[model samples]
Target: MNEQPRNPDPEIGDAFYGFVASEPQLTWHDGTPRLYFKAGQEHYEYGPDGSRTKLPTTFHDVVAFRGAAVSGDETLSKLDWFVAHGRLEPNTNPNTGVETKEFIANRLGPDAARMNIEIGTPRRRSQMESPNRRQPARQVVFEPPEQDQPEHEQPTRAM
Candidate 1:
């Protein structure tokens, strides 16, 4: 099978974040807050005497979500549009609604179609949604030498 060789560029990283919702408790429909982080970026503010104040630097994004009510869910669901054909979708039932946050992932590239998020993005769905109780144990396997080997074979390693 043909495959593109993996690029060794270490700068590549996820650019977008957030997830979808089923039934949100907020009044607004498009309330999802997508979050993103970049390196070496800073916030600039203009002071009174024509001086600019470049505060500390940290990864910032235009879609990153913030928590409300002091102590609630940190994940944002408003930005999780039912993305099809790489476009933002309108609010609707089953397809789109502000329920609880679902998943938060980062964009793969300029395509904005592919996303990668933390594995098992947790959801508050009932038992029917989540079934696995305990994770399975990890295991490794080893293969033996072929049967047609020489009788005087010393070991598994070939000289």
Candidate 2:
């Protein structure tokens, strides 16, 4: 029997939802844009009776790179609720040798809790020809094919 070796190091990532605590600042590094901001993460405590209590919000430093940085700079404003998915990286100060963790976002976007979003179909090439082109028709109904239905209706079937 042959045994497969497992890798020792693995990548870890995290995501958090919070409100912007400060205005985003855009900077350039080696021709790449970087967006930096602070996020206020709310904390809550639940009692035995299911009562929820709000705690002091914790502030975190967040950075987005390149295209994500550009979009974040344009779309994010102070106090706006947003979500970020990324990994925590360590940054060490050259003068003090002190290290701190910063959230480096691979993806970031507005949180649905405070924003409305619509899903639309991709526009055809003709639609791109004009800046004033009318919006495409939206999908209103969905019908699954009958062939995909199981012979017997299970009470807890996965869709």
Candidate 3:
């Protein structure tokens, strides 16, 4: 039998609206890395007949390296079979794949090259460059290269 250690409640009290996620991409909040997932539950009631349901949105703050991603996939699960994998790199670019464009939390050091998080992702302090850079159209104002015209002699006959 395995026993888990009892953790104390936060000084500010517990949260009851959003769940603390542990689904990867854990991050830090104000320089502090929160390793634990603070979960909460809410009640949901069904239509006329009889049904009670609960819909939860867990909010977690795990610590990982934070940086500007070159690109990566969104919705990592959608990108491939997770197989309950513990390591999370999201295999794809946030700008191109299954990851959301919000923020990517990856491990420090380079075994890899880049990382990206799609929009709607989670983060306490995240930053990203605009994927779509508006290129200014090249305008060619043709001035004929300012060719020196041949010197024209005035007509000798001054009639």
Scored by lDDT, model 1 comes in at 0.34
Q: Which stretches of candidate 3 lie over 4 Å from their true place?
A: 1-24, 29-63, 66-140, 152-159
Runs in model 1 deviating more than 4 A are 1-26, 29-116, 123-136, 150-159
- Residue-level lDDT of model 1, residues 45-149, one tens digit each, is 998899998876543212223333111122223323222112122323365664332222222111123333232443222312345757688788889876785
| lDDT (tens digit, per residue) of candidate 2 on 123-151 | 22233456577889898898976677678
Q: Highest TM-score: which candidate?
A: 2
TM-score of decoy 2: 0.63
Ten contiguous residues minimizing lDDT sum, candidate 1: 102-111
* Clash pairs for candidate 2: none
lDDT of each: 0.34, 0.81, 0.33
Flag the better candidate by lDDT, 2 or 3: 2
- Candidate 2 stretches greater than 4 Å from native: 1-12, 94-97, 116-159
Q: Pairing residues by index, what is the TM-score of model 1?
A: 0.20
